[model samples]
Target: SVPGPASKSIITGAINFPFPTLRLTLAQENLSQFHDLDDWGFQQELEENYGRVVKLTGFSGYIDRHLFVFDPVALHHILVKDQDVYEEMPKFLCLDLLVFGEESSLPWGTIIANIAKTMMPAFSTLNLRGVVPLFYEVAERLDFNSISCRTSLELIGRTGIGYSFDPMLPGQEQTDRYARALRGLFVTAFKLQLFIPLLPILMNYCPRRCMAQEGGKLDGSEEGKDIMSLLVKGNATADAGMHLADDELVACLSMILFAATDTTSSSMNRMIHLLALNPEVQHKLREEVLTAPEHLDYDKIDALPYLDGFVREILRLYPPVPVMFREAMSDITLPLSTPIIGSDGTIMHTIAVPKGTSIYVGLAAANHDKSIWGEDALEFKPDRWTKGKADSVETKLPGIYGNTMTFLGGGRSCIGFKFAQLEMKVVVCVLLRSFSFSKPDSGIRWRKTGIMPSPYVNDEPKLPIVVERLRA
Candidate 1:
């Protein structure tokens, strides 16, 4: 039992450990279609299968993992108390490979700090303030007419990169080309997922050219200086240290755009869907926005208890980063308030773990856990936050600001956490002020993109809802 949740996987999945990998063997053919992957269906599966804690042993095809469903007290000991013994898990080790086109430390170590270091500066007040006008510009452009999700992504590319692309903005071949490129990259990701994990057998002898296929030539130039340029010119680039390769640029910017455009936009669209269904909550939120102060300072925006609660509830109910991974770097014992029930999971005061284990932390699972969040955990109840009754609980949870690792906690938490909150608050204010929206005649459901969990992207966020200008 590596004390830390981040490093539990690799440690527990080692040959010496007893947990079984979730990756099904070829014999188990229908694994992928195990569930319809609908809202409640997937949630139930997670609760039943991944919801429990175990130390998995041996490999199963592409996956090597040990899910830990230990009690909250045990979670605290591993995460905060004995954090050093555990670092990030093995699966998460390659985050650099997938996200930054770089290498991640086997034992998490300073990787998260590196992330914090590289990205935090980009969200500085000056930089954040600079993005607001652009935020409005982008949102307004999308609101003008019904657009496909892919088109919205193109809009993101243009607005974010400072290019004038009209893939959705009328006829612009330049914009059209960018859209094609973006589609190609997404296709690459989808295909790579199926072919990868050939592991030492195939990857070692694999062609370097194939492995080195980059996302390819996205236009990073914008008006004066975009965030990409800022990073290129800022301290992150100056302090690039050997790890900051030129290859890291597109990937880094990709991640930023994913966070900025995809996650934020998806969230706003979901809020619209949720509100359309719940008129009372919508009315109250609108009322709150109407009373919001004029200046729109970051803190003031965050200070709206009802609004903040609504966002938090939405995040808790429909988190974007549904899952995360970590690898164990060494042998350690996991201290637990709850004991593993199996033979290998015997209630030894502590659990043993080995190196190379892949630990998967289901943030969504833990967030909605019945034991921690109370019986109402499954239901959407924003009042739990506003009421403050849940806040007073003296549990092993991560604490309000840093406790719950939604934006992820630890050295690798989301640096843009503050910025994201500000953006959401601002958008909520703007939309709530401008209109009272409702769903279209045909009922709509947010589809999944598999990256972030729900309020899915089936239509690329075309909610099919109609909006009338609210009385001024």
Candidate 2:
């Protein structure tokens, strides 16, 4: 039987004895259960079974001993106060290096830190005005009944890196060559993830087979002014450590394309799905969006309160990358906000972790924690943002935007968070202004596919919707 409150452990003169920790098994017996739980569901299970923070070990294969953290205070310690102690998983770093072709971590890390500063204006409220027409044009062309992947790719291609994957004019051949290349890159990357030791060799040869070896330039009106061009030009003026080689340039551009495409598309799909299910919310959003002038600039469109609230709510509830893996760089102690009873009946205020310990930072669970977001934290309620209910809830999550773990926090936070927000707002506003969306007879479900949590129906990534033209 589990220990009761009366069974407290006796403390020694100085040393606090370690409690026997729980073992989270990924063995054959529970593999099905692990797979059955979606990202949010799995995190929920962890917190429910083992307090907000727990140690998971006793794994058989490649799985290593790790600490699972869902408590905000522990999260604050790991991701904010003493982030250097918790380094990003080497596998993830290897993937980044393989994708970006940057061997110099110092320069790449420095560049990532300043990327938002350099690129913010391009994705800013003022600069995004230039792309509003393009966004609307694509929105108007969306079929809505089937795949929206192409629409997202086209958006990122044109405005993000100043490339184009779709045909410019009707009767022209499709410029989907870039899309095909990216598909190959992702497939190769997946293989590399499984065999990370093969990265050095794979990185040397994979680009050739993945359609990135030929080295092609983007064709568009904004060609010279695109982010890629800016990066290339900036690198030219930078020191050797900060400069990107030819292969690195290709890898970096391709990485951005991969990062922006599926994630943003999935997010847009979720927003539409949620809005369609909730007619009242959709109507409110439409009302707010329509209130703005037809010629509204980026700043004007961004200022719409209802729209902002709805987006924030969706991101909070359904972050794309639900959990991230990290490893302890050295021995460290993490402070906890609330004391938890250990397996041996000792109350733990702080947890000590040793070097090489694998750690899972629970992003979705932390976002939905009742202690932080209140009783209705699990529910999808956008009004939390409007009436200042969310503001009242105190949280210590180190997120980059909207005080949520959707974009993460600390030095390694998502750099394109602002760009993503601007893109989402622009897409949502343009779509809401022209069409009223309703859930189709067929329902949709969200599942994690190692890429991001995306809408799926019949075991495929899809969002089926009924779009009605809103008469002005």
Candidate 3:
């Protein structure tokens, strides 16, 4: 058996599955460290203390053991080579079905394949280049505080679906119900973590409908530019065998809208905060963006080396979703890139995992691994890429973006990653050139809420930064 920390309680395992009151009390005291595995220091401790493949006790005592793995070779096998054997956990699918509907499950079926094919054109460089001005238009109106969330939502709405959630004009309130709902969805889901097992049952009793408005009939002749419109157009022309049903189309829309927003906003928030903290890095990046041609297209924006490195470094160190979960479909042995000494003092190269065992893919841990990224892995250094440090790291790990696990890998990897990158680059470039950001008066702390983490000040979910308009 894989070695890990012993459970303090037979009932709760390694986790503190306390009652609501007790949990609240612990949280109030800031002593609920064990409750959140996504804590950066805790993640590092797991890798440093127990090695890459630490067995963790899950709910329901010894019978429920989970493997917290970040081994590069093991990650390759799980996320790429043998993905079918390590499918998304059932609870995750159930949650998606409850939140977005049954058709939201995009990991399987020819419908997904068709959807990916249809949406490819919309995410292409040519298409994104057309949307760069819109990105700048939104960014120009944004102030440092309370803008990332709304800015990202509006950007996706305009570029992804030809809609506008907010005009983003000064002093205008975001009153779109759908946009507000999308913003609060993850936070609402995070509060319901304890009730995930009952989601399917609750969904049966009270079915949740997709919030996306029904797409009007589309003929192939309609030259709509947005992603959803393109999908609708494609579906209209598709053969009978490949046509997507109405529910499926709605599900796809909701899933795309939801998937594209929060993670991108979180990443953008991290970038801004990091830039504020590192003024020199910010100044250097600003210079790179300022020196570039006034007309910044997708190619020009993507070509900026310092901007690219800055984004990569932020994603590498502080991934929006730090950990992802998968479940073993059958008993299997996982190969490790580096052998670890077992509890019995014997070096083990592979681990035997049973069917139904849960696995936590340690994304942040892998990114911070000293062996792969050298001893300075924990430091925030974008120059690593420009200095050729990324060359060696790229060949060792199987990541879809930047050779880091920020966007994951293989078939189930983020489909709109390119779209996201373009959005971040365009927004950051526009913001950095127009304004300067400095740390806020209050101390900022990042707290993990469900799958994604957000910055907070004095227990409120907020990122306060001092912003000054730059002289033209």
Candidate 4:
């Protein structure tokens, strides 16, 4: 059996106590610590005390034991080599169905894969280059107070679906019903986390309530330049078997909007925050952007070495979605890069995971693993990418981008990663070129809200940065 902290209650397992109770067990403390937003210390402790792979007791003593895995070889197997076996949990799919819509007869994975394939050209370098000016247009008018959410929504709206959520004018408020609902979805989802099992029952009462209101009208006909338009066009031409149903198309609209907005915005906000903290690094990056040609197309922006390194380092260190969950569909033997001793003191190379076993893919932990990324893994050093140090890092971990699990890996990996990268770089370049950012008076705390964490100041979702315009 895998080694793990003992559970206090066999029925509750390692479930965290809501009320403060005296004489808590180690298992309770471990589980409680797991919920912390800044989990770096907890991750390190897990690695030290329990190795890269720790068995966590959840809900039930033995039946509900979950594996918290950050082991490189195990991660590769779970994320890439044998991803099909470690599929999304049913409850999660139920949550998706609740948010998106009814799943078609086709497997959810197949649907996502098809949609991702159809949308590839839309996010291609040549295509995204045309939208650089739009990104800058939004970035230039950004207010640091609510910059991430509103700006990201407007950018995605204009470039992603040929819509405009906000006009970016000073003192203007977003009045679009769809945009309001879309922005609220994350908070709604976060509140509904505990009720995931009841999502199926709730679907019967409020079937696609959120998406059905506005998403159905987004038929990809507006201007015909956005990704939604391309998807609709592609689906029109695809063979009968490959054709997406009406609901599926609608789901895609909401999915793209919801997924793209929060993650991209969170990352952008974090980048700005990091820049404010390290003025020297920010100045250096700004210099790189400034020294480049006045007009920066996709190629020119991408060619900036320091800018690329800065983006890469931020994504590596602070992946918007820090963790992802999966469940085993069948009995499988999971491989590990290093052998670990079992609870019985036996050195084990491979572990047998039965069907229905829960698995937690520790993305942030893997990115910060000192063994793979060297001793200074915890430091925010963008130069590692430019200094030949990145090459020394282990390559066994499977990630879609920058040798980190920020975007995950395998068929279900983030399809719009390229689009996101382009969006982030373009916005960063535009913002840095026009303005200088400094830390605010109050400390910023990144709280895990929904799928992505957001910056909070004094318990409110705001990043109050001191911004000074450098040029008119």
Sort by lDDT, top down from the best: 4, 3, 2, 1
Clashing pairs in 3: none
Query: What TM-score does candidate 2 get on C-alpha atoms?
Result: 0.80
In candidate 2, list every pair of residues with a backbone clash: none
Which RMSD does model 2 reach against the true structure? 7.2
Q: lDDT of candidate 2? A: 0.65
State the lDDT of candidate 2 residue by residue for 44-79, as single tens digits: 766666778765432331234466677878888787
- lDDT tens per residue, model 1, 80-171: 55556656653333333444444533345454455457666666767766666555555454431124244345444443444444533454
Model 1 clash count equals: 27
TM-score per model over all chains: 0.70, 0.80, 0.89, 0.89
Clashes of each: 27, 0, 0, 0
**Superposed model 4: Cα runs more than 4 Å off:** 8-11, 16-27, 37-40, 143-145, 194-223, 387-389
Cα lDDT of candidate 4 equals 0.77
Q: Is candidate 1 or candidate 2 better by TM-score?
A: 2
Model 4 worst lDDT run, 10 consecutive residues: 202-211
Candidate 4 lDDT, tens digit per residue, 258-283? Answer: 67887888898899899999999999
| Candidate 3 structure quality by residue, lDDT tens digits, 249-269 | 665676577778888888889
lDDT of 4 at 354: 94
